[model samples]
Target: MSFCSFFGGEVYKDHFKPGVYVCSKCDHQLFTSRSKYEHSSPWPAFTETIREDSVSKHQERPGAFKVQCGKCGNGLGHEFVNDGPARGSSRF
Candidate 1:
């Protein structure tokens, strides 16, 4: 299946309703749509995760982080510190 089939329409342009979002391949619950927010970026954004271990984070470099599905290792997106809706905050 394509990435958008599980994630939604286009990344940032798609507005997901409040619900639970899971991995398309494994059905592992990854995020809740309620946490989804609009940041004017080119992908869907979330304020937080449904659980502490629902997702995984990888540090690509000294200060860069890549967020992905914990169960299937699907590339969800990235996390940026102090670059969200609020200053000095983080979003995925």
Candidate 2:
């Protein structure tokens, strides 16, 4: 599968330069390049957020959380614990 299907962006197996990333649906700044990191998974990963309220998390299923755009409530991805390159939890 293409990585774009996961994050709505062409997946490059490299870190993105420091910049702003917005929600595809609402154009709200949901993540910053500084927070992004390369993961072995299909989609990119983020270790942190630019702001505390940049995104919203919802429990999609048991033991899994669905991340969404805070402004427009567009589904972004899922949150996984201990699934990052540095052993940090990440948003996939």
Candidate 3:
């Protein structure tokens, strides 16, 4: 999933309807449509997750974090801090 997202995969890049995005391997709710937004990147970008614990974050390095499914630990993508619409918010 991370590879596909990094390589500009076309899974949910254009999906803007009100719905929930789940993990392919576990069906755990990860993101919601309300948080979805259009971005210049080819992957689907969200301003937030479905819940505070919906995704887990791991510090890959200084100022970099990797995001994964909280329920199944599937590699979803990366999270960028202070780079989203809201102040101090994260982009997933």
Candidate 4:
């Protein structure tokens, strides 16, 4: 999906089940319901991952980073600094 469409909060707006979210390409577990919480952002936000190695981060540019599946290198989302629950950060 395009970045705007993916982040437009339309994909998982109704997904409230407590389960692990995985990469669609490789089934690599990325985030879990426990770390999820509501935010004003268009996309779903997670405070943490299932594990430290669950996803990989790449510097897209200065002060910007992109998140990808650690196992298959698929783009998952972007990371941003904010007053989120996870030590003042959040991932989308």
Best by lDDT: 3
RMSD of each: 3.5, 4.0, 3.0, 3.9
For model 1, residues 10-92, the per-residue Cα lDDT tens digits are 64337566677776667778767777777677666777777878779988865458988788888777777666677666787
Runs of candidate 3 exceeding 4 Å displacement: 1-8
Assess every candidate by TM-score: 0.75, 0.74, 0.84, 0.76
Task: Flag regions of model 2 displaced more than 4 Å.
Answer: 1-15
Candidate 4 Cα misplacement greater than 4 A, ranges:
1-9, 61-63
Model 3: per-residue lDDT, tens digit, 40-77? 77778888888888989999976568999899888887
Candidate 1 overall lDDT versus native: 0.69
Candidate 1: clashing residue pairs, number: 1
How would you encode candidate 4's per-residue C-alpha lDDT over 1-92 as one tens digit per residue? 11123643567644567888888678888888877787777676777888889889988865456998889888877877565766757555
Q: Tens digits of per-residue lDDT for model 2 on 1-92?
A: 11233534554446466677777666777667777786677666777656767778878776567887778788777877566557556555
Looking at model 3, residue 43 earns an lDDT score of 76
Is 1 or 4 the stronger prediction by lDDT? 4
Cα deviation at 40, candidate 2, in Å, is: 1.4
